[model samples]
Structures are given as structure tokens and as C-alpha cells.
Target chain A: MSGNFIVGQYIPGTSPLHKLDPRTKLIMVFAYTIGLFFLPTWLPVLLAGIPLGIAVYASRLPWRYLLLGLRPLWILLVITFLLHLLGGSSTAPPAPEDVWATLGPWTITGTGAATGFTTVLRLAWLFSAASLLTLTTSPMMVTHGLERLLGPLKRWRFPAHELAMMTSIALRFIPTLQEEMDKIIKAQAARGSSWRYGSWTRRAQALVALMVPLLLSALRRADDLAVAMEARGYQGGEGRTAHHPLQMTRIDRWLLIITALAGITIILWRWA
Target chain B: MNGMLTLRDVHFAYADGTPALQGVSLDIPRGGKTAIVGANGAGKSTLFLTLNGTLRPSQGEIKLDGRLMTYGRRDLEQWRRQVGLVFQDPDVQLFSASVEQDISFGPLNMGLTEDEVRRRVEEALIATGTEPLRNRPVHALSYGQKKRVSIAGVYAMQPDVMVLDEPLAWLDPAGQQEILALLAQLHRAGTTLVMAVHQMDVVADWADMVIVLQAGQVIYQGAPQGVLAQQERLLSVGLTPPWPVQVFHDLRLAGLPLEGEPPLTRAALTEQIVRAWPKK
Candidate 1:
């Protein structure tokens, strides 16, 4: 169970991708997600690897590590593939040339297999791209990037900084909260409140007993953190200055330009 | 006048009307080791929070450095930075995921430039011997390591008065000794070190001044040797008297020849025994 938690799994590295301004990486991920969905041809989607390869290489992370990071998503990917293969467009006949097999009302068409594989690939790409962002950028820098990207949204009266700050704090506390949850569960177990020793309903009822205290403690910790922050002179969202200003360097601009050009070419190639 | 923190008639009750502190008044002298000893829920934590402006008094005043500490934003910020309050749980006190970020949080809140914050973070990381764990995730750290990181977090702020609640609680013996040594370092550096501890014997050898709290009020405040010397008084407040105090009590009960006030420490008690031993 502990092997799968990845909310703040930022591996400490000094790769070029790690050095890129968070905003640049964030924008690239955003554009990549949109292109993954809108690109018209499956071949181009498969060929979108050139830019991803560059990013993977620049991050200096072994491809195996990136794939291993996707372990948790494999279940969802399989589900997506199975659902598409078994349950889509019941009335549509398989293209005669594309039909590979037919078993009991389920026609195994090449198109179905292709679509299923495409969906699975898209899901994998999305997950890996998102992981790359988190694996390289620290939570603090991610929040800074989000705040900078959404800075213009302030014109719409959006609480961009406040939102980003909440994300940042929540990101920071994810592991702490997870550990607290583990401790609370163990403590409850020690006190003989068996979560798994009883009937399903009884175990669920036991979980309620455990969850209440966990939530209460979490809230209490939040209050304590707020007080600590206030005491340390955290004023508010506005007029707060940064110690590590998120300024984009020339390299960041170059990366952004490369991302735009690569993204446009991929989408155009997909359409053609 | 510079470092004195005084609380006068500070009364506080929870929203449900359970009284936590009742007219507690005391003066926390500057630049020395002070311990607030009390039974559980005797307002030791409440007093620490109140001193640092985290809780508002029902009807009383807290004066820090001769200035009234109002609840205004600027005033509270100044008071908070000056009086770093370390909660009993390092888990709750630490909000940042990384040790370096957690330590930097306090200094960053002080509005220090990034370079200065980094320097302070480095200094604190070194001070607490957490340099090796500087980039490690907070959740990956052990309880003792987390405690050190938490202290380093506040140390980076360079608070004049560091209030640690149960500083020694949940620590192993070696961890306890390490923390005591760290506290000594803090004392030598002239940060007024204040801790709320449950053990009576602990404050005896460390705290220069000990304040005993009973049922939300100061029962006694003076030298540890004086307050901790009375075994009966210590037991009355849910504390076993210090070991030396108990030894002193047993020796006096045994009709052994002993002079002066009861010793509060092991070394003093040993000397008392050697001097008062049966004539050769």
C-alpha cells in the first residue's frame, strides 16, 4: 500500500527539465493534454513521441523509472481498454477488411482493437506527462508556476494566489496527512477497534469510528498550522513578496517556443 | 525591560465555557531557561499559546518588552516572530513537506529575502544537525528527526523567546539528551528558552527558574531548588518529587545528618550523602 502514494513524489534532481521554470513545464503539460485529445490521427498521436522523448531525455530520468511511476494507472488503463473493446457502438458493423475474429456476438474488429489501444495509449501519455511535471518540479515551484500562469485571471477577480496557496499547502500536507491517517488506523487497531476483524458492515462502522478522529485531528492540525503561519507573519494572498521569485529565464523562453512549435506541428500532422 | 514577558490576570475559557486558564499571572524573564511545570490540562499549553498571541485572553493584558501586545495584525505578527512557539507535536507544527522548506517557512514568513532565508535555513539545518536530512520528505523522517526539524524551523526565525511544549515528550533517552544539549546551545546564544514539561525532575537540572502551575494558576515560581525541594507539595500537584528531593526526604526521615535546603540534582544529592556519611 505504501509503494503507491505519489502526491508529492518529487525526486530531487538537477536535470535541465528540473531547471526549467515551472511555468514553462506547466504550459507544456497543458498544451500536451489538449493536443492528446484533439489530434485527428492515431499515427500522429503515436508519433508525438519526439517531443516527449526530448523531455524524458532532458529530465535525465530512466524510462523504466517513468514507466514504474505509472504502476497505479495500469488498472485504470486496462479498464478503459476493456470497456472500449466490449461495449462501444453495438449496431455498427466491423469494416470487412478490419474484422479479425468473431465470437458469440462480439466481433473483434481491427478498428475496435486500434481504438482500445489508442485510448490506453492516450491515458498512459496523460498520466506520464503529469507525473513528469510532479517528479521534476517541487510543490512550491508548482504553486508558483500556477500562480504565475493564472496571474492574468486576477482581472476576472479570481483569487488566483489564494487558490495556488491552498494547492501548495495541501500538496505539502498530503504525506503528513497520509502518515497521520496510518497512525490513527494503527492506534485504533491497538485499541481493539477492528476494522477488518468484523463483518463488512461492522468493519465499515468501525471505519466511521476511525475516520471521525482522523478528520478531527486533521482539522485541529490545520488550525494549528494557520496559527503557526500567522505567528510567522504570513499576512495574506495580496502584497506578499517572494524569497524565490519565479522569473522565467532565456532557456524558459526557448523551451516555451519549442513546445508551441512542436505542439502545433503534431496537431497539424494529425489533421493531415 | 527588553526581554521580559509578563501576563497579568490572563483569563481564558473555551467556547463551550470550560475554563482553561483562570487569572494566570507570571513574568517570564529573558535570556534564561524557564520551565512551566504542570499536570495535564493545567493551562501550560494555554499559557504558551496566550504568551505568543495565538489565543486572546478573556480579560487581561500581556506585555512583551514593555509594550502591550494587542491582537492587531501587525502587533501579533511582531509578537509571534519574537516569541516562537513550538507545539508539542512536530507533525502539526511542521506544515511543509520537506525539511528545508519547513525550516524556511518561518524565515520566509518573516519576509526575509530568498538569499537570507536560504542562509538562515542552512544555519538552522546545521544547528539542529539536520543537514543530512535537509531535502528529505517530512513524512519520511522519524519522530525524533521531525522534532529536530521542527525546532530548526523556529530557530530559523531566530525568536527571542522559544516556547516549546513538552520538548522532551516522546523522545528516547539519547534524543532527550540531544534536545537538552540543543536547549543549552539556545540558552548560550541568549534566546530565552521556555518549555512546558510534565516531569518535575527534568526541570530541576536544567531550568534556571521553574514555574509550577496548578488548576490553571501559578502555584509557585522561583528557583527549582526551592520549589522542587518540597516533596509533599510536588506530590500534591500530580508529580512525584524529583529523585534528589525524594532522597533528601528519605534521609531526613531516617534521622541522617544533612544540612541546608534539599538538593534538587543528582550531583548535589551525592555530595550531600558523602558529606553527611557516618564518621570514619
Candidate 2:
């Protein structure tokens, strides 16, 4: 039952992508995602692959591992592709110049396949790009990076530090909660709760059984954690200092420049 | 009067109106291995929370280092740093997935520089013999190892006094010895330890002083030998005298002349019997 819990997706390494400032990687992933949407055609989407490959290389994680994580998305990828293919653009009529083919009652057109291919590319790349961020960066680094990026909002009275602290605490407690959940499940199972074999309604009842205790225990743990954090001198977001301060490096700037150039190149080529 | 912690009629009650600590007063000595012993319903956990203001006492007061305590933000932040607690369950005490990160949590909260926190983390890892596991994830650890890492997290704070709730619970005999030895090492280094323990023999063997509680109040406050000697007195409050004391008492009842201060520990009892062989 605990097999599904992933405590940390971070695979620790000193790879360039891993060493890049999380803020830089975050913006790169964002810019890359936006570029993915704006690329005009399949050719431009293919051009976008250059930067995606570069990201995969820089991350230094196993290419197979990165791609393997996308395996579960194949179903979504196929569904979107089929939807685009079958449901093409609503139009008054297909122009004679538009390539078309008839398959019995269904008319398959060039625009259908093209649009389907492009949408599949974008969705798949979106997942891969996001995976790169989560795989290479530790959750704590992501929190700190986001907080530092949000630092400017401090002028507007935003509690960036508190939000960041909450994120870090949430990441820390993920596994603790997993362990507690595992305990509750096993306890229930020991008390003769049938979790594996049941009708859907019975299973829903079993789920409710599991959820009640899990929720109660999770609340108790949260209370304990709040008290523990307070006891550890967590004095809110005001004047609290960081031990591991985040500092950006030249490599981060260079990575951002490269990502920006890639986005521009894809746009120019697609428009041309 | 001035000990590491001085509680004066400290009282705590739940929001639903059930008392958890009832006018409990205690003076935990400055730098020794003091044990708090009580049955399941005793106020051991409640008293522990009061020491660091985790759950503020409902009434009365506590003093640390000869000064009265307050639960104000700044006061509590300072007070908590001075008294670190290793909770009974390691799963609850350990927050971070990374062993090193969790150990660094307390010291980092102290507003220490990264270098200083790093140093203290190293010191704590070595103290708890968890240096090899510094990079391991918390969820991957065995129960005994997790307990050690939990202790390491608190130890890294370098508190003036450490309070551990049921530190020996769920540990094998060897694991128990390791923790006791670790506590002894800390005591020798001038860090006082106040532990809530259940085993009467452990109280007799390891503690410089023992505090016994019953139903949210202090029943006995004295040396383990002095308290355990009065078996009938202990029984009324839901405790039995340790085996060594019972053995000595039965021998005396059986017409043996072995008198002066019955042994408090098993080792002491064994030594006495070995010496008294070939009875005159």
C-alpha cells in the first residue's frame, strides 16, 4: 500500500542543470512551455526539440529514466492525438488545395494529422520539461528559489518567506504522513478490514474507513509539527534569516540567455 | 531551588476541561541523568511540555536558570532553544526526509550561520553515530536508527538541558544501552538530561534522582533507592519496588541478617550476595 508514495523525486547530482539556479531553470521551463504553445507548425515544434534535447543532456539524468517517466502519459498523448485527428477545425468547406483523403464515411485531412501531431508534441514536451525540473532539483531548492523570486513582492506586504516555509514544511512532512498512512492502513487491515477485494461501493466504504483515521492522525501530526517548529524558534516570516542563502551564478544567466535565444529562434523560424 | 528547571505548582488542563497536570512542583537537578517514572495516566508528558512551553501550563509558574518564565513570543523562542526535546516517537520528531537536513533544522532555527550549523550537524552525527547515514532519507531508516537520528536532531541544537520522553521505549537491550551511554556522555559534557522512563530498574540503575507521578501529580521526589525502598508506599500509587529491593526485602523476612540499605540495582545486589556467601 505504501509502494505508491514517492518521498523525493530528486536524484542528487552535480550536473550543470542540477547546479543551475532553480529560479533560472524555473523560468526556462516556463519560457520553454510558452514557446511550445506558440510554435506555428510541426516544423517549428520539431525545431523546439533542439532546446529540449539540450535540457535533457544538461540534466545528466539517465535519458531512459527521463523518457520512462513519460510512459504513463502515453494514454493521454494518444487520446489528445485521436481527438484532434477526428475532430479537426470546424470549417465551411475544405479548400481544394487542402490535401484530403476519404476512408469510407470518415474524411481524414492533412490539417487533421498536422494539428494532431503538433498537439501531441506540445503535450509530451510539456510533461518532459516539467519532469526535468522536478527530477534534477531538490524540493527545498525549489522552495527557496520560488521564495527568492517572490522577494520583490515583500514591498506589497506579501509573506513570501512564510509561503516558502510552508512549502518546505509540506515537502518534509510528505514522507512522515506516508508512514502514518501506511501504519493506519496496516492497523485497519490487521483488524480485518478487506481493502483488496470488494465491490465499488464496499471499496468506497473501505476508503472512508481508511480516510477517517488518516485524517485524524494527520491533524494530530500537524499540531505536533506546528508545536515542534515553534519550539525550534520559527518566528514567522519577520526578520527570520536563512542558513543556506541562495545566490545566482553566471551559469544561470547564461542558461537563461540560451533559453531566450532558443525561444526567439523557434518563433522567427516558425513565422518565416 | 535553582535547578535546570524549577516548576512551582504548574497546572495544565485540556480545552475540554480534563486536567493533565495538577499542581505539580519539581526541581530537576542542573546536570545529571534524572528520570521521571510514572504509569500510563501520569503527567509525565504534560510536565515535559510545560518545561519548554510547548503547551503552556494552565496555572502556576516555571523558572529556568533562576529566572521566572513567560510564554511571550520572544521569551518562548529563547526558552525553547535552551531546552530541546526528543519526542517519544521518532516519526513525529523527524520532519525532514533527509537525515542531515532534519539534524540541521534545530540549529538553523537558532539563527546560526551556515558554517556553524554545519559544524554542529557534524558534531551531532558523530555523537549519535549517524555520520554514515547523514545523506540517507529518513523514511529509509530502521526504527532504532531513526530514533538515533531523532536524538541527533535535538542534540545538534546544543541545548543547556535535554528532555527526552520515553527515550528507551521500543529499543532493544543493546539499543537501550547505546542511548543510556549517549545520555551519560552528554551529562559528562555538562548538558543536563531529564527523561521520562517506565522501567523501575532503569530508574534505579541510571538515574541520579527519580520523580514518580500518579494521576497528574508528583507522588514521590527523591533518589531511586529512597523511593523504591518503600515498596508499600509505591504500591498505593501504582508502582512496584524494583526486583533488587524486593529480593533484599524477602531475604530479610526469611531471617537473613543482611541489613544496611538494600541494593537498588541488580549489579549491586549481585555483588552483595557474592560477598555474603558462606554466611557466618
Candidate 3:
């Protein structure tokens, strides 16, 4: 159950990608995502996976775990792929040789297969790139990078520091809250509250019971955390120095330049 | 008496008008271990809050090193910097994902330079013996490790006095000893240590001064030796005398000959009994 929630799961390492500035990775992933939309054909989509593949390799993340993390998303990816496979474009008819298979009123064509395969590949690349960012960078570093990126917006009255702090805190408590919930569930189960074998309405009722305690505990925790924060001299994030301050190193700079060049090249190719 | 922190006639009430602290006055000795013991409804936690400037006393005042504490924004920040508070539950205090980052929060909020914050974080991690867990996520840690990281968070601020609310609560015996050792280390380094604890044995073994609270008022405040000798007074306040004290009292009541005051700690009791044993 816990393995599926992989977005914020960080694996500690000293690989070059792990050592890169989080801001660099953030920007690279952002540009890569936008470039992914510009790639028109299956060939360009496959081409786009090259940099992502290199990133995954550089991250030194265990391939088994990385692949396992994508298990939950396979359902969505398969659904999208199947939709495109069965629902071919209405405007153009494929060459007779392009006909692949026919099932009850639905015809599978080469173009449909290409579109489905390309769409799945694009989505996989997007997921992998995003996952790689989190896998290498700690949540604190990500928050630090985000705060630095949003520093300029402070002039416009943006509460960037507070937002980052909140993000970091939320990330910290995710597992704690989860553990609390697990305990509550086991406690409830011991009290003869069947969570697994309930009717739809019964399940809803049981969930309400579970949710009330979770929400109440969360609120209590929030109150205690606020007190703790205040006792530690937290005052609105003003004048606070970051322990892991974000600074772009030479490698970070090179990575940024390479990502920008790749993005522009993809845009030019799509335009041409 | 003058000490690191002096609270005079401090009274505090919740927003709902329930009094948590009522006319509480005490002094926490400088560079000394002061333990506050009380029942569940007693205001030990409330008093710690007032000490750290988290809750302003409704009526009376608190002084730190001969200076009256102020509630102004800047003053409160400075006050909190000088007096760090570690809550009983590490989950509440550990707000950062990583141990190092959590420890860094206090020093960072002090507006120190990045290098200085890093130094302080490293020092705190080493002090609490949580250096290896610095990069680990807070939730991944065991309860005892989380407890140490929480202490490390407050220690990074390098407060003149550290106040802990039930620092040993819910810990195993070995973990409690480890924390007590950590506290002793901090004290040896010149930081005043004040804690509200329930373990009577810990209070007797560790605290130089013991303050017993009943219904938000101080029932007794003095040396642990003097306080632990009065078993009835402690029991009335919902606190039992330390085990050795109880045994010492029982021995005297059973018509056994024992000299001097009752031993406040196990080692003292054992030594006294050994000395009183019949000759071979």
C-alpha cells in the first residue's frame, strides 16, 4: 500500500544528478515537460526519452524500485493507450496496408497504433523525469530551491518562504499522519469495525468515523507544531537563513544550458 | 532567589477562562537541573510556555538574568532564543523532513549566516549523538531517535536555559538514561536545564532542585533531598516519592534502625543499607 505513493519518496545518494542543484533539476524537468508537448511523431517522442533515460541513469536509483513506482499509473496509461488504439482519427482513413486488426465495428490502424504508442511513451517520460527529480533531491532541497526560485516574487507580496516551509512540513508529516491512520484503523478493527467487508453505505459510514479521528488528530498536531515552531523562534519566515542554500555550480549551469538547447532544438524541429 | 529564570506570582488562563497557572512563583537555578512534578491537570506545561514567551502571563512577570521579560515581537524572539523549549512529543517539535534541517530551523530563525547555521546544526547533531541520522527523514526515525532530534533542534539555538516538558515520557529505561546523560552533558557545558517529568526516580536521581505543583500552585520547591523526604506532601500532589524514599520510609516504619534522612535515590539507599548491615 505504501509503495504506490512515490512522488515525494527520496532516495539518498551522492551521484552527480543527486549533487546537482535542485533548481537546475526543477527547471530542466519543467522545460522537458513543455518540450514533450511539441514532439509530434512517435519518432520525436522516442527521441525525447533520450535525455530522461540519461537522467535516470545518472540518478543511480534502483531500477526495480523505479519501475515498481509506476505500477499504479499503468492502469491510466493503458486506458489512454487503448482509447487511442480503438478510437482512430475520424478525419483521415489509413492506407489499406495500414489496417492492423478489426474487432466488431472497430478498426485498428497503423496511425492509431503509432498515436497510442507515442502517447504512452510521452507520459512515461514525463512521469520518469518528474520521479527522478524527487528521487535524487531531498524534500528540504526541493523546498529550498522553490523558495529561491520564488524569491523575486517577494517584491509582489508573495509569501514564498512561508509556502516553502509549509510544503516542507507537509512532506515531513505525511508518514507520521499515515502511521497515525494505520494505528487508528487497527484500533477500530479491534473494536469490531469491519473496514473490508462493509456495504457501500456501511463503508462510507466507517470512513466518516475514520476521517473524523484523522482530522481531529491532524488539527491537534497542527496546534502543537505551531507552538513548537514559535518556541524555536520562527517569526513569519523573515530574516531566516536557509541551511542548504541554493547555489548553481558549474555542473548545474551546464545542465541548465543543455536543457535549454534541447528545448529550443525540439521547438525548432516541431516548427519546421 | 536569583537564578537563570525567575517567575514571580505568574498566573495564566486559557482563552476559555480556565486557569492553567495560578499565582506560580519559582526560580530555576543557573546551570542546574530543576524538575517540576505535578498531576495531569497541573500547570507544568503552562509554566514552561510562559518561560519561553509562548504564552504571556496574564498578571505577573518573568525575569531572565535580572531583566523583566517583554512580549514585544523582537523581545519575544530574543527571549525564545535564550530559552528553548522542547515539547514531550517529538512529532510536534520535529517540523522538518530531515533531521539536519529540523535542527537548523532554530539557528536559521536566529538570522545567523548560512555557515554559522551549518556549524550550529552540526554541533547540535553531534551533541545529541544524532549525527548519523541527520540526513534521514524525521518520520523514518524511531521514537527515541526522534526525541533526540527534537532536542537537537532546540540545542542548535544554544539557549542559555533549556526547558523540556516530559523529556523522558514514554521512553524505555535505556532511552531515558541516554536522554538524562544528554541533559547532563548539556548542563556541564553551562546550559541551565529545566524539565517537567513524571518519573519520580529520574527526578530524584537527576534534579538538583525539585518543584512540586498542585492545582497550578507550587506546593513545594527545594532540594530533591528535602522534598523527597516528605512522602505525604508528594502523594497529596499526586506524585509518589522515589522508590528508594518509599523503601527507606517503610524500613523506619517497620522499626528498623536507619540513620540520617531518607535516601532520595537508589544508589544512596543501597549504600546506606550496606553500611547498616550486621557485621560478620
Report interface Cα RMSD per prediction.
2.1, 2.0, 1.1
Interface RMSD of 2: 2.0
Q: Give me the runs in candidate 1 sitting further than 4 Å from their true place.
A: A1-8, A82-101, A155-157, A188-194, A263-272, B1-3
Local distance difference test values of all predictions, in order: 0.84, 0.83, 0.87
Worst 10 residues of 2 chain A by lDDT: A1-10
| CAPRI quality band, candidate 3 | medium
Backbone clashes in each candidate structure, one number apiece?
0, 0, 0
Question: Least accurate stretch of 10 residues (summed lDDT) in model 1 chain B?
Answer: B1-10
| Ranking of all predicted structures according to lDDT, beginning with the best and ending with the worst | 3, 1, 2
Q: Where does model 2 sit among the CAPRI classes? A: medium
Q: Please, what are the lDDT tens digits per residue for candidate 2 over residues B21-53?
A: 999998988887788988887888878878888
Assess the local accuracy of residue A189 in candidate 2 as a C-alpha lDDT between 0 and 100. Answer: 86
Q: Point out where model 2 deviates above 4 Å.
A: A1-8, A96-99, A102-106, A262-272, B250-258, B271-280
Across B1-280, the per-residue lDDT of candidate 3 in tens digits comes to 5588998999999999999999999998888889999999899899999998999889998988879988998889889999999998898898777788789889989999988888898999899999999878788889999999999999999999999999998999899989999999999999999999998888887888999998999988899888888888788878888899899989878766777888887788888788766621
How do all the candidates rank in terms of DockQ, highest first?
3, 1, 2
TM-score of each: 0.91, 0.93, 0.92
